[model samples]
Target chain A: MPEIANTAAKVAVAMTVNGRLVSAELDPRTLLVQFLREKLLLTGTHVGCDTSQCGACVVHVDGAAVKSCTMLAIQADGMSVTTIEGLAGASGLHPMQEAFREHHGLQCGFCTPGMIMTALDMVARLGPDLDEATIRENLDGNLCRCTGYHNIVKAIGAGAAAMGAGAKVAAE
Target chain B: MYAFDYQRPAALADAAALLKADPEAKILAGGQTLLPTLKQRLAQPTALVDLARLPGLSAIEKTAEGVAIGALVKHAAVATSDVVRAAIPALADLAGLIGDPAVRNRGTLGGSLANDDPTADYPAAVLALNATVVTDRRSIGAGDYFQGLFTTALEEGEIITRVDFPQVERAGYAKFRNPASRYAMAGVFVAKTADAVRVAVTGAGQSGVFLWEEAGDILASDFSPAALARLELDPADLMSDLHGSAEYRAQLVKAMAKRAVAKALA
Candidate 1:
């Protein structure tokens, strides 16, 4: 185990981040967001409210969306962790990200990364053809302080449709 | 957050042993609540024995009695589990409404029940469904599980293994959630079995989650929203915060109860 620093306690964490396997020895108190930003230097995962309230720290742990700020780095040991940066491929942006940019879903862009991650997860869970009320209700965890979320909701709907079409193409 | 010793024991026996050895040890079930508290410096534990690595603790199955939900079962799992949705749709619905998608994905049944936050949504379901909380040592009735605000019948070092909610004829949960944080301001859960009816209220209790005996009695007789007409809660024991007054919550208790009853009927 590669220890990071000299501390009373250090937890060895080895996990698949994005598509790469990364390992580090960190303090037991280090949140998953801290591990992503400080250790891996994947700053795409923003930490808005250190408290779990704001969804700015949302990430996919084992394919499920969870607030990274509320999770300890050691807790995600051996789990596949996906941050916002993982969404885009080499050639193009992820459908959700493209949709947000196309629809102007953000202003300050602080909450965009979490929003996209959450939106993609929502589509995965709820399916492609999401209604307006369902999309609004599904956005309980994510909050965009800018643009009043009108465009964000619209972008998610369009993104869901695009993802469905993309899946169809892949299937074909 | 303060640095602490972290142990992820693979076996339930080992996890229990780790907890028993340290006086200031805390069990990390989901880290949905404990982590936030630790970040705020409200709690400082010497060690956290994580139970998420333990196998067979996330199973959600329909049993002869009811739906048996393992302690490690996440809220999203309960909400989306076909077994849970089929056996107890209302329970699934209630789980679906807890916190938000991200929170639900990580939060677990054991963590919620063990913490017993007064504003929590699971206690209402547990109380109204008359669920049995199965621990490593013994099984506790839902009525006896919740003691007070942020308190439970769970003894130190004891871990909840599973929660068994009896299959009901019909059940419903309704809540007016806090806009910022999805925690319920006032929530009600009503469940009707072949022989009995239950009405449990959460979020507005000063002493924490409790059963509305009067409403239960009324619903047991007629089982309708109108049955709660004469129901009036004593504001003296209800919670009052910046969100709402005790009087406001008392009124909301009745309103949510009515809506829950209507939903169950629907």
Candidate 2:
């Protein structure tokens, strides 16, 4: 159990994060972003813009990519959440992470976590046959000021293929 | 964010009870807008009645008349729903265009309609499609739902159950989004029903989402983009901001209406 709120307005929340069942007592007003970063120490989900415009805090809530900044911790009670840290298996980096590394997809790496999380979602939804235009369109939510998106787009396309192959390997 | 008591009632009836018990309680839908508002201290509620656990409130079901989307249905769900695509492709497109993917995954139909932000996309669809907003207490016509900017006809304790959209002959929606924020600068939804034609506009009006009666009347007789050639919106009734001038929005209204009519006919 984690204690994220000291106030009397604390509410109990139990949720799954990164394949672990974590429970905490937090303020009813505690945002999911704060719960993840301050309480759970999952700082990989960055908070670039507090206004929900920047997708740096994007994470999977019950398998859908959502801005953690805009959601309350209590809202996620009994839900499954996956942050950027959860992408890799015990063996090595996730295929998407490998694709980004191979393609030089990051610059400052601040937006990489959110970008990777968003890419994982896109690959899951659209499958491996993602075009440049679709990738660009889908990246509308995540903003990266450094890479100019050329390398990031390439990384996502390559990552999509690897993820598809990875799924096939597991299925086999 | 201000401290508040959180309540997650398993049943809608229990949720309504909690709401009725606490006057300062607010219904927490998807929390895309409400949470941000709370974080900014724009609103202070004594309690938040979480409706996420309410089972039937999130379902998308086809009715005898048309499609009924549960109030808790997220924008992404609506955007990707097969039923919505088959019954109302325009609606799906509109849902897809709302905010971004992450925002869409969390923003709900009920929250959007309940908040009734002037620039919101759903109000235009509700108005143009002549949908029925079913609430816990009673049903409200789409025409009567919206009152003004950030306002709706819903009572303090009323909870929206679902929105029922009738099967129209054809419908289309188009919007010019503000690039930075993605809020609609000017959005229009045009629908041709069995008995009448409706044209609704969101984002451009100072008084909030409004019906373009002049264009709707013209399209009722002659439903085509060319039919709007003689029609023009009064710039005085439109909103002017840094993104666009009143005159520009007036022109956009006509242009978007034309495009919507074309899409409906397509």
Candidate 3:
């Protein structure tokens, strides 16, 4: 909520990330991508483009997926963010990750993390009715130079189905 | 990006005051534009006013009049919000069509309107919806808000607080997306208000967005795509680049406008 202050001003920023509180004293110009990669050593988020064109740097801010490259560390102050590394638990890989592995959705695996994060958000909102057109429409933002999106779409469907089945099993 | 001073204020007044104190400082919303520009060294601000900590800046409120979108609300939030999807589907459509997943998740409507990129989709919505751009100091209407390409009425350090779109009878959005960037090659927004039909075209215009009076006339009379075919697009006003020609974009504006009307009427 900070307003525009004098150019000489500096401030401390703190954020709760992946259920843990982390604090940093950073230049206001430090991007959230730099902070995550260079500072916190969370290299799970990749930087594919200097511009915001690629979805490689996507992360979750307060449960909402956002591009980390387009954000500042200070902007995340007092906020909560979830990155790719945070998706897995002691139980093992998140359902989306397992599905990607099973589906051969990745070739080089560079875009896998961002793709998985985006899939998690899309499945939660779109449910299983996310047909081919819907998946194409939804994933237009995340680019894949390897062009491995055909399987990626299938993987997302399989993952959502698995998650749905898991929910059903628990309910039963 | 070079290092600079950063401040986070938890209140609106404090943020406004800080902006008032430092005109050179840039207000950070989603950073989808600012960060990239910074990395490109196109824009270098000595100070950064981080607005993410401010409360009530990300809410989508449904009022009796219309819908109010907070300035800091992400494009993804607006595109998926129940109220926006129901009240102003074109706004939601425009929000959903922005760059891509990452861009939509971090880009804000306010930021899009403020940036005034010719290829940006929200300007068409702002003009067609006739929304009010409310800033820290005053409110500006869509008619006068967008000056030209990559230009807006906002003074240095001014922050857009909320955008208020008055309820219209029917509205829809249509776009011919650029293959590589996914930005609109030409996008049109058509809205039928109680008083008159408003048509706005973006991406294919030289001056960013322009009023499509002929298309508006067509909508006012028939409100259909077939009616749109009768109106002619002047080649003088269309934008041209690697993606399309001025004449090509002019035709697309008409085609997209027709499609938008068809969708709206449907």
| Clash-forming residue pairs, model 3 | A1-B9, A1-B53, A1-B54, A2-B9, A3-B15, A4-B18, A4-B19, A141-B100
Candidate 2 residue-wise lDDT, B1-266, digit = tens: 76778998999999999999999899999988888898888877888898988989898988888799999999999999999998998999999999999999999999999999999999999999999999999999998999999988999789999999987999999999988888888999999987789999999999999999999999999999999999989999899989899999999999999999999999
Segments in model 3 whose C-alpha atoms lie over 4 Å from true places? A1-11
> Could you tell me the TM-score of chain B in model 1?
0.98
Which one is best on TM-score?
1
Q: Model 3, B1-266: lDDT tens per residue? A: 75567767889888888888988777777777778888887876767777876887788999888999999898888888889988888778778878887677778877787788988888898899888999888999999899999999998777888999887899989999998877888899999987689999988888888888877876787878888776789988787788889999988988898889888887
**Deviation (Å) of A153 in candidate 1:** 1.1
Candidate DockQ scores, in order: 0.56, 0.53, 0.52
Candidate 2 DockQ vs. native? 0.53
Structural similarity of chain A in candidate 1, as TM-score: 0.94
Two-way DockQ contest, 2 vs 3, winner = 2
Listed per model in order, the count of residue pairs whose N, CA or C atoms clash below 3 Å is: 0, 0, 8
Q: Would you list the C-alpha lDDT of every candidate in the order shown?
A: 0.91, 0.92, 0.83
Q: Candidate 2's residue-wise lDDT over A35-75, tens digit each?
A: 99999999999999888888999999999999999998888
TM-score of each: 0.97, 0.96, 0.93
Give me the runs in candidate 2 sitting further than 4 Å from their true place: A1-7
* Model 1: CAPRI class: medium
Which is the winner by lDDT between candidate 2 and candidate 3?
Answer: 2
